[model samples]
Target: MTDTKTVLITGGSRGLGRNMALKIANKGLNVIITYHTNKAAADNVVAEIIKTGVNAKAFQLDTSNTASFDAFFTDVEAYLKSINKTHFDYLVNNAGTGIYVPFTETTEAQFDDMMNIHFKGVYFLTQKALNLMNDNGGIINISSGLARFTFPNSSAYASMKGAIETFTKYVAKELGARKINANVVAPGAIATEFGNGENKTNETKRGLVANVTALGRVGEAEDIGGIVAFLCTEDAKWINGQRIEASGGCML
Candidate 1:
């Protein structure tokens, strides 16, 4: 079996997840990334990681569908066997989408979607992953700046992230006996394709975010990846059950 550490990242086909996968791979960790759809894009990411001289693979997953998880893990187990490994060393719960409907206009379906994807999905996915995670492994749960500060149309999204933040602490506490660390990374408005690329393409929105951020700019995917990679390293071994906000001091 291979002795190198490996990480499993959800929604790693593009955006921040993709950046995390690449950065972690650069740190000499093998990567297993999940894509909801777009196998071509996922393959491209795997290829890019391979270029870094690290083993990488892409698997399909719908993070919102809990029923598919058991079957998905079977696939993961088979892949792990092929790699001569029994478990991965880190799990990054980064798969999710943004919903921008105003609180007054948000419907039950929107709320359910947010809850399923952001909170429920992450909770159960991590629960199931524990079987495949080695002792001393770490989990990084992706959250958002809106959880800490209000955003007019982000009520549902932000609330779900808040739930994730709290849930992460419990995970850390409960899993401490296993030496598993669970932490959350709350990123600010990053310039990615999330929410239809509003922060990246909408000039007015970009300016508004920049004005509120102490760094005077919107965050980029690159800005958050290395932090996640760092958390999986030995240097961050003692940082457990904490919410690390990577927002460039937004709304401060």
Candidate 2:
């Protein structure tokens, strides 16, 4: 058997990312989470995962800024060496924030933020990480259900997810030589601290979402975490270039 697998997740200080880190740790994968400014919260997550008996660490990463990726990976490599490893096993591109602006009202800055964090960041991060990913390892890019169904104020964000879906397919195809598989995980409306906590705090919005969702409510962060963890496990080895939407049957 190989050494313990490690997963690098962006934006894992809290919310769905936090839940995913914990769930993946429960499966015996070492975890490395990135936070933009919440080092305290990120440290807390590391501590929580350590209690699960898996190795964990947190690093500062602003996913939107490509200029810092080189330095970021340098630190990651140093950390991996300290653990007697040379590469990570999986990459989960989950760092991002949602902007609630209509298409007409969306500014160039808003569009760029969405593009940088969702598409460009995922694209280049995976490119650089490929050097450090084990053969036959996998990648999971976080998309959103909005890419399938329409929602107000999400045009830019959804467009990027659509791009991710397309990019993932290409990654799977090109990386076939290396046996590195890539897939997208598109989550439906989830109740988390993400996106200013709209799904969690907007009671009227929650009522409307519940009316349309077959599951009768917005999805919890826990609902999506396990699916991500499963993809990182051996059971999902054959799954590649697939867009798995964990949206609890919403808008169906």
Candidate 3:
């Protein structure tokens, strides 16, 4: 039950972030979404959210480039103050990317990119955004089920996701003084640009994942989006620092 009411979602141009933005905006909440590269896609999402009779906008952001974070926060602060506001209500660190290279073949550049985008970005962005959030506000970090399972080529990527979950716990502890909530949302085998139709191959091992999933199919972006929206709702105030997997029971 926060008085300051606005939600900022990273990677909100497409996939799960886009769906989450639309859902929250439909509930009459102010939304500020960020995109790494796809401006057109972000604008499209903003348009859809506005159609729901709510306020929503998109800003360009590169999660891997942490140097620009301060400027981004500055812009967000200015926008909120213009509306006679001082703090945001929630933050969703959903911006991330992936590379399907074996550990032995993974280059330094690739490893750095994944770590920067998945872990470092979430860490520093949260640090910067926390000061601008209101009491009882929510913080959600998007994780992957690959962090829990043994997915060979996903070692580097999954390791970063693992770090994010751990970081969420510490954030919850530190931000507790302000009564803000922080948690992790892990999704399994989602049908997104990260590794959907384009990356399909015989060697891409998701057979075990598919066979073990009780839902009998991979997840869609909206599946995770809906869960994220629920987590930020008033009903989810007690949920903090926990990893809630929206995997449809993938691998039990």
Candidate 4:
């Protein structure tokens, strides 16, 4: 097999996902990114990655809908086969939307949305993706610092992240026999359009996040992509089943 590796990431159209795609491509890895709806944005990222002379493609995916996974993998497999690659090297489960509703006010539908997108989808997606991933490949799951610290109005969302963190450890243990590593990258408050631009547009919230962070500022998308990309590289092979919080020491 060719030594060049391929990494597939979900929600790679914009924000941190876009940054991760570019950085992973910087490591000379071919990239396959799944976008929920924004084909224009996904295409833009693909264009950027291809400029480095590496292979890149974008496919539409509704990560919360488990029924769509079979078709998604079918398309992805066809693309990989066309490139003469039977298996991918990395799977980054990073696609999700945010909803900020207080605990008491959070409804069953809201809670289920969180579970479907953040926990259940990731669980089964990785389960199915495992068959197509090569031995010694790595799985990087995007979690949130909210899983560790407390925050109002985040009960539903954060609870699911907590589940994912636990799920990742089990995956690392079970997949160890295959030499496949699974880990979580929990990011702190980042200045992005995520969570309805919670930290990006809210100056008051931004100030609060900066005060608590040891780095004395809210994290940028750039600060995190390299961390995720590094985990996909050779140097990170020894790291497994750990939650690496790239939160700049928030709530310390």
Candidate 5:
């Protein structure tokens, strides 16, 4: 039961990010969330987080807009100054886009889109955020089980995720002096709007993924949210530069 601290989660407007914000906010942490589009949705998430009697707010952010990372960091610093908080305790680099194309059909544009969103964005975002983060703060990059397992249409996505895991290790090693911890969370196929439409997941496909899982059910948003929340707690203070997979043994 560590003292509640501030947490910033990107793409926190809906889907897994929204769920994670709710879970973290309920634990008495101040939530500063970001969304790429849909200001209305971001506002709704903020309202929900506040309903739990915790401090929460949302901002517009496009992670793929890597050129704006510095400006975004400035905005975050300004927000922190307004709140009189010196440093934030957690950063979840959860904002990302998905692409599904056969290896033969995947074009250069498609490959670049996935790489920019998943790898390049996470890389610069963490670099910018580290300066503003508190000592002993935690960073959780959202990877996917595909990083380790082979998936036909997910070559690009999985490759980027693998890159994230490597980046986490490097971040952890370099930031050790500050007591900062960086880690990755690899989730199995979950029911989220990540790969498809907004707020709509492929129920049948998700169920099939669950059937292959040891748990016999697709993962819910809360399933991953809860894990991310825990990593910020003192209980995980010693866990750094590691990849924790919450896939119910999927593909095992």
Candidate 6:
């Protein structure tokens, strides 16, 4: 019943997810973020958003575990009731991890991990989320530039992202009748703690990425959050089933 819009972001304890949560909150939307293990970090993000004069909370979620999603949504529903809202307005499937093993060296466990977290998790999570999402809402699926362009030792990770891209298109198509828009945002090499902070800490890797990017520098988390926030706005109502790569023209 509340007039304020709400967004649910997964893996928002840190990294790009954290940035997106904060940016979305700054746009005057309430935020519910999910964290895998870092409760303190998630709580900190919530506190920061509260200071921004928006209602924000963090919940624990293991996106890779499908069995837990039902319970997760139950908690979400209770929280929504407490806030005097029936459904959320946006869903950002952003929880993920990186594995740098080469295709030949990639173990079955690693591949399955990638599939569970990146593809399957996003797939079913979105499916279940529909019941709790408002009509005319939006879904933003996070992808990676490696999905479009090849990269050494990233075959497994990139393949899952490619699957998400295709899945997001189908979501957009099928959900159009409900007035919900689905889109994917693929970020270029970003200097975040993702992948163990290699891009942020390794000067050689940063330099290499900078050389290939048209912007002449590796992307920061700040570079990507606004794009996700924009998609949730009324201005992006017509933009559906699209893949918007925030890569600074890498490999172009």
Candidate 2: which pairs clash? none
The superposed Cα distance between candidate 5 and the true structure at residue 79, in angstroms, equals 1.1
Report each candidate's C-alpha RMSD, comma-separated, in the order given: 0.8, 1.0, 2.2, 0.9, 2.2, 0.9
Tell me how far the alpha carbon of residue 82 in candidate 3 is from the true structure, in angstroms, after superposition: 2.8
> Where does candidate 4 clash, by residue pair?
none
Q: Would you list the clashing residue pairs of candidate 5?
A: none
**Which of the predicted structures, 3 or 4, would earn the higher TM-score when compared with the native?**
4
Local accuracy of candidate 3 as per-residue lDDT tens digits, 1-252: 234368999999988899889888866688899998889999999999888776777899898888999999899989887777888889999988878789999999999999999998888999899779888899999998888876678889999999999999999998998989899999888777774442234334456556779987777777877788887789899998899998889887
**Candidate 2 local lDDT, residue 230:** 96
Q: Candidate 4 regions off by >4 Å? A: none
Candidate 2 matches the true fold with a TM-score of 0.98
lDDT of 4 by residue, 80-107 (tens): 9988989999999999988889998999
lDDT of 2 by residue, 1-252 (tens): 238999999999998899999999999999999999999999999999999988899999999999999999999999999888999999999999998889999999999999999999999999999888999899999999999998788899999999999999999999999888888999998998878999999998889888888889999999989999999998998999999998878788
lDDT of 5 at 177: 95
Q: Candidate 5 deviates by what RMSD?
A: 2.2
Expressed as tens digits, the lDDT of each residue in 1-252 for candidate 6 is 279999999999999998998999999999999999999999999999999998988999999999999999999999999999989999999999998888899999999999999999999999999999999999999999999887688999999999999999999999999999999999999999898887799898788888988989999999999999999899999999999999999989
Runs in model 5 deviating more than 4 A are: 1-4, 197-204
The runs of at least 3 residues in candidate 6 whose Cα sits more than 4 Å from the true structure, single-residue gaps closed, are: none
Off by over 4 Å in 1: none
Q: Using Cα atoms with residue i matched to residue i, what is each candidate's TM-score against the true structure?
A: 0.99, 0.98, 0.93, 0.99, 0.94, 0.98
Candidate 2: Cα lDDT at 49: 100
Backbone clash count, each prediction separately: 0, 0, 0, 0, 0, 0
What candidate 2 gets wrong by more than 4 Å, as runs, is none
Against the reference, the lDDT scores of all candidates come to 0.94, 0.93, 0.85, 0.94, 0.86, 0.94
